[model samples]
Target: MVAQRSPVDLTDRRALLARQPDDPTVLAEAQRLKEVALLDFGIRDSVVASWLYTKCHHHIPTTAVETAAVVATGDGSCLLLYNPQFFVDIGLAGVRFVLFHEARHLMHRHLYAEQELRADPLFHLAAEVSINHVAMVRLQVTGLPSRVVPGKDAGTSHEPVGVDPREVHQRYADDLRDQGREPLSYEEFVDTDLVVYRELKRMRTPLVMPVGLCIHADHVGRHGSEFPADAETVGLIIGEALAEAIRAALRGNRLARDEVLNLIDRSEGGGDRLTRMWGNLGAAALRGETPRTRRVDWWKRWLADTLASKLREGERLVYPKKQGAVLLALGHDPMLSRRGRERTKVVLIALDTSGSMPDEVVDWVTTLVGQTDGVESHWLSFDGVVMPFVPGERVYGGGGTNFQNVVDYAEGRLAIDGVPFEVQPDAVIMVTDGYAPHVTPAQPDRWIWLITNGGDDWPEHHHPPMACHRVTTGDR
Candidate 1:
């Protein structure tokens, strides 16, 4: 049992309207509790939850709800709404469970948004049961979280209000057995949120009443005018947090990877956007297999996304065609000139032509750079010398690979076809077998290396490391 303040004291309707906490002591206590829980999450390998909490605004609003929740702020952000007295009532352990539970709820919302499922009370209960189960296992807590009894003394009347998956499964088994139907085994029953919902819905008698108390179980007017948040805004905020978590995991954070894989597994029910985003962005790398069968390889998708980010790093201004038309209509000079000449990004692609390079790799690179809207691509094949070549044109090199020669030409120390390399490339992509000695580029940050199979990735180990990945060819 955990100690908590009595909710009976704030039962009056007028008190709910006071959005801000008047007492500094109560506010400080709540903040202290949240900080401790956050620390615990960091130490316990709950990276996604911890990261999400850090990105959100923690608000101690005087609301009628007893527990905390993650809600949107009407803007393009989210906040964790908690009650100070509720935080003080639940001990540190309980606070941790509640906070984690709320964070998981936000993730669940982002993963599943089907209207039919949202409308199903049984499905909502299933979500609560599933989330609470994960929380208990991850937090290593044997007992379910207890809610503060409204009319009782501070610590004497705590009741277990958290949903128990085993209990629900048993009830489901009994109901299905009575109707001469077979119930799924315990393992299958609690496999995932959507799976649990499907099993629960198969029961002869629907669980009309909720087994325990869950704030989300009551979907009626819960986030009314009191909380000015919409599902879409909150979903976007959580999505951004999830993306950051994935990036951290890809950067070799073991704890972060564990949490992200767990999240990706649970969000298996999301639609195409989720599938494409999760599949292409390191999920396959983390799971050791691509998420789904697709025509485009995961590494190719990764390269395209990486290139987009590097090329779109700087700012560019558009003329705003509508603005010019309006100005001309007002009898003023339209001034329809380009505002930013930096719109066209310059990119250099250097292919190592010493050995037989994969045609598929070159073709893919050509398609990506060609399809891009505003780009000026410089193609070159280098062996002992750098030779400027056009896309789809066969350029051969046989003697030996020299990375320094390519670098010299790119940095203007050497000339190709009597043309000085005047412009600074926004991005330089090097595709090679990685057999040559490594040379540092003038702007190492602007370089991306794609090493062939069984090739050295020395650039990744270089100081101030550049972007690097191993390109897998189907028929090399």
Candidate 2:
């Protein structure tokens, strides 16, 4: 069973608060230490450190807590809590390490956000190990000096505190080797948060996490347990901060750049979430050799442009009769006019419901089309048959392809339950694998074909070329 720390008692908290010094000198020194840490962060990893400072509010609340911690305020901002006495005890290097450690915890929280993963004891241990390891390496510190207790001897042995990633890896390696299994290298052992958890779970006897080490550990009755509602927003903020650090590093911030790049290198296993976030953030510095900073997916950009163009309102200006008096006074012709266009564009989206279509593509397309404004969407999931669906409704099918059924429905030749499709759609977007025979639509110019991978694309080679673009699945 995992060891848990008892919650801070109210009486003890009150006592601790009462003993906290109100001396100007001590408070001033605490503020100076915080500033010094920030300056050091700017010198080491300029962009991210600066970004973190802006998002987090620093407080030196009187508490019995030994070290510093970071907690979310339920708003977009975070709190960096420290005890002035603790700072005095750990010295300047420890202060820097603790500050960096807390910042990394926030970063870890932003990255590995799945609730299942967060609840795992092993995963929590792995995260602490990884964060501490990164903090030690970046700050050039081997170990944290143990905090002094009031009743403890002054000259007692100063054992290093907190979990060490290397030690944890060694434990796993020894356990695996004794079981006649191959061991992963230290680098591979702690590669990702999930990897660490998975490997540790495989062991019959995994190392137990010590209590009172990780401040963010989700034990019962923990203080400052509230997390923000907008995790994506927090993640984006962190990403933007990392991006700024990368830019600063490129512009001659050597120490800052190196630190930022090292952190990025260590964070390799975040999968597509990390890739999509970092890919567009001018991450050439992270790659070391690649000078091509930004790498955005072309298809997404194209799709955005297409959607914008299609949804744009056709413009025509007219003078209102009420403004005629003002216009005449300004020596303009008194012509009561107005600007207007057709009602919301009716878009028929036909999904080829053959078993070959990817579900992810379908979901993405549906969400995109559904969310668009000034457009009335009519969804149809078709195989050899066509079935009409309302927005936010599920479409289930497994049949052969039939493009004619979609056209017939859009052209009002077919009716469902005695209700004909009376509205002539302004645009018809058909998402298909392009394996079936293609029939000419009634409005060929308004037809947009999004062909999937490895599917036959006949429209591209048709006698009169139509609006055809490959719909990228992004699976590759």
Candidate 3:
């Protein structure tokens, strides 16, 4: 039997990236490729902005870059953290390769798992989509920007949708499979040979990559005993132990039953998928972070808004600083020196209780909030009107949630006494079913909504400036 990995040392996974040091040239190239991709594509740099790999040869049980992917998954969307540690085999080519791969995962909406995601067809499309996002971007940044992105889903009215994976033929990806040169991820580039010529190559390091990624942000006691489980090297290690998890799961697939039997067999796995899905998606969801160089408040507001904004339009949280510290608390000698300038915030639960609010859902909301720290919140229940209540304060109303009441209550000093709007809140955390006709004008900068879920679809123009996360009351 393969060893069970000594019960996972959470500290050890972190130590893997703990500074050993890397060549200056490899480091420079990775950042360079990223900036080039951004400038070229008009693709917002804020989306998966920078990446780095560990500088040393550390065996990451999995075949991935050696730094954790910083993200805003808790808010309901996909964002990426490209590793900066480089393995220069060909200049930044490998860096570009991985970026393209991960980008495919983002643009194509694989992160949600909100919908059914098959393994191949959409996966293949993700690869092609990135290639196209890059090709169009190159022309835009290097020379004249492209009026049209040559990508598969460029300039579409709706966000790009997922394609059926099983339908995708294998030849598409098989054609680009390593070309027998060895996995490109193992190398990095430092030189530029041809504008479009043959001698293009980068240098290589032994190996370095990241592992044990948690989709949601980890606050105080969310994970509980499983809080720091050692899934790191979980899928990373390549030993028989690693292969064992892989083999066991794959073995379950060996006896391909008929579609009817397979459909019936998926009940538990389906429930688990749902459980794994929005467990943190209730009223307490958040995207935590540290302060930036200066513009502290703006940075915090950006972090909050990005975290809470309705990500359907492509919102992403990109951390310029190191990933580990991004989620650390801010206190003395904290990440940012200007605390006042950078507003720190507590979460607010803005429930639309106008005639729109039903008693059952209200109890549900209170139950969810009760699960966590109750002090970090202010409750506003409104319908064709608005009323802000303190934690435990009681009030009632039922009618159309006049689109402006909740916003009015949240912004005015009435709800939160003595708190200035600027230094006011970090996030609004609206709990609505999206039935409201409209939303309040966002405070130029604030996380207006962190966890937005009710029972209906948001009106087209009713969306707020902040991230609008959607959660449902029923079964997944």
lDDT of 1 by residue, 1-476 (tens): 11233232232234444654678787777776776677667556487787677666444456456577665656666666677777777767888888888788777772345778766777777887688888887788887767568878955788775787778889999999998999999877877888888888888788754432555454223323222347777767776667656766766788778888887877676678778767645575687766554555545766786787677533212235687579769984333122343478888999999888888889889999998879999999999888898986879898788999878878888876688788888889999988888889989978889888788888888887888888873321
Candidate 3 lDDT tens digits, 141-255: 2311112123647533222111211122122223235343422221111011011011111112211111121111111112343222122222122121112222222223222
lDDT of 2 at 82: 67
What TM-score do all the candidates reach, one by one? 0.63, 0.53, 0.37
Give me the displacement of residue 269 in model 1, in angstroms: 6.2
lDDT for each residue of candidate 2 in 1-476, tens digit (9 for 90 to 100)? 23334345322334435545577676556666765666567545344655575555335445544456554444565555567866766666777777787777766663346777776667778887777777777777777656555555864545555788888988988898889998888877766666777888877587777776755563332353332224654565576567556655654577757867776676666666665555555464245542323444434544444554455434312235567678768985444122467578888888887867776667777777777777888888888889888756877788888998888889999987788899998778888888888788767767777888777678767756656667663432
Better of 1 and 3 by lDDT: 1
- Whole-model Cα lDDT per candidate? 0.72, 0.65, 0.33
- lDDT (C-alpha) at residue 13 in model 3: 40
Model 2 lDDT on a 0 to 1 scale? 0.65
Candidate 3 segments exceeding 4 Å error: 1-89, 98-343, 354-360, 363-375, 383-385, 398-401, 413-423, 429-440, 443-458, 463-472
Ranking of all predicted structures according to TM-score, beginning with the best and ending with the worst: 1, 2, 3
RMSD of each: 13.0, 16.9, 18.3
Predicted structure with the largest lDDT when compared to the true one: 1
User: Which residue pairs show collisions in model 1?
Assistant: 3-89, 4-89, 5-89
